[model samples]
Target: MSEQPVVPDVAAPAGRGPLLEVVGLAAYVRLGLFGIIGQHTWDAPDLASSQRMLAIGLRVGEQQGRLLAIGASHGVEPVELMRPFAGVLDSFEARTPESSWWEGLLKGVVGHGVASDLCRLLARGLPGDLAAQVVGAMEYTDDDERATSIVRAGVEADGRLGSRLALWGRRVVGESLSLSQALLTTRPSFGELARAAMPATVAPEGPSADVVAWVLGELTAEHTRRMDRMGLAA
Candidate 1:
């Protein structure tokens, strides 16, 4: 009889991914704005925005690298975990199309916030050191402040823009939820991670339906709070 080749379990307990791609995306966006600034001398605002964006990109990129390192240390390939949700980021970028400077800024807010929230949720179930690394990768201290300033400026400049952006923000929430569900469906590993992340209140014998509802409810509530923080109607 021929000996069988041993196959390692891909879904075994291990580390996870990060918000790296999002920051990389933001970097490209900033560079685009920088080019626009170069084209127009009246592009000081964009220049300033570009500089800030570059800083965020650099910092977040470092954290992202750290996350990958930590994930590798734990024998987990973060890319495998992230592959299923690739569409989510693309969908978000598509849904929140940037037609103006203010809109671009709003996209930055929504993108960063959503990625951070997802990373935080995933980090909940991970081992201490790994979880800390995952969480740390998403720490954007100035996101809320910067978002607030941009939203306020856009609103003050044109009240109608605020209303439009409010609607856009709501759409962002819905799309994010949709993407999340889609990801879970496509990725069994992610579903397992989410299950492991559940609180103690969810009994071992509890129905998975209940667990799903609880997680969705928590995510929805958090989404509403985030919207409110951005001065939009939840």
Candidate 2:
């Protein structure tokens, strides 16, 4: 019988930001759990893919958290805050198929969730025009279509039998929005960002209502597409 090769523990170097620290911690936990399971199982290929997925998921989560932290600290719009990270994410398209699958799932879940949360937050906290504009910015694109494809592929590869996994993609977005709002309410920095991003204006009236409605319509359509990609309807 052949001896199974041990996977090395990858460490994050010192002075890495808090976001990376969080990612590292989560990655380690995932690695350890999956490693233990792999040791007891015969499915080596599945185990390998699972590890890749967990690693990439950790990286994406860390990056998103870091972006949010920066945005909150600088009091910038979330879109402006995420622009640089989006560039970084764009570069990962060339990663290995396993890595790409993992990364895409993580990005899609986080992206959808954060956008949803930002929209809901702004709706309650900011002037109607600015809030609507910010919400409108969450619309997915052709690029997002590719990401969802990866997620679908990953799920298929896992050989896990259930529709619940498909539903997870949509659930993450809803949960993320709710969780982010709770986080924002407690985090003074997020409040500062909201204030900075918001323009001084009263409630919407007349034409402003139409503009807000248009923005909401666009956001709703985009979210619907995302849900469809996740194999969820309504």
Candidate 3:
């Protein structure tokens, strides 16, 4: 496999070349999370750190768009590939509305937490370039970690609120699983890819159910770790 691709930061280094070839699907995630904060900048912060994070988020979004343009050059419209997923994600957010400012932040934490784990697992069988893009997308920026730490601090400060956020986090995970299952059912290729990437814990004749179980187990373990870090119940 080729060495992992490095996405140059805010300076937007030249000669991206083949690195721009792979569409970073994970970039949509950054927009969804950061866009929330962008809409409510007051909720994010007015500090230099927050401004820097916003800049990174914007740059990440632009790089992802450039990748999409590359895909268009190959006669594949990124919109076509992404349309199927937009509905499920929108539905999840609609159903699990964030009631408060912190709840919005927690939503980011939960979103990034589950998404990073899924990307890590799913990238395993992809082509080197694609896998690198996914891994790069999964890497948490300082702002991402800081957001998580803020949520964790909040949970640590109040047992009652922590309990509530714990339940909220689980709900988010549940929604994520539901969305994953929906994807599996709607997108046969996705299921096949997941199965192909799955480890050989099952017999050769094992049902697809086994693969789903393995994925769920891995996601659950990671989610638990995230919750534990936040002093929240899983």
lDDT per model vs. reference: 0.54, 0.40, 0.60
Local accuracy of candidate 1 as per-residue lDDT tens digits, 103-182: 56555555455545654665665667656656665565674565456566657787788788887767666776666665
The lDDT leader among the candidates is 3
RMSD, every candidate, angstroms: 8.2, 13.6, 9.2
Model number with the top TM-score: 3
* Residue ranges of candidate 2 with Cα displaced over 4 Å: 1-147, 154-163, 198-225
Worst 10 residues of 3 by lDDT: 4-13
- Candidates sorted by lDDT, descending order? 3, 1, 2
Compose the digit string of candidate 3's lDDT tens values, residues 1-234.
255333222211233222222233344454466576565445554475356446645654664575465456656566533333343467767877888666766776786557556546666546676666556655555655566677777677777888788888888888877766655445444555566567676542467676677777878898887777777788
Global local distance difference test of model 3: 0.60
**TM-score of every candidate:** 0.68, 0.35, 0.73
List runs of model 3 lying over 4 Å from the truth: 1-25, 44-81, 141-143, 202-205
Q: Which 10 successive residues of model 1 have the least lDDT summed? A: 20-29
Candidate 2 lDDT, 145-184, residue by residue in tens: 5445545565565645215444444454444444444434
Model 2 is weakest, by summed lDDT over 10 consecutive residues, at: 88-97
- Of candidates 2 and 1, the better by TM-score: 1
TM-score of 3: 0.73
| Pairs that collide, model 3 | none
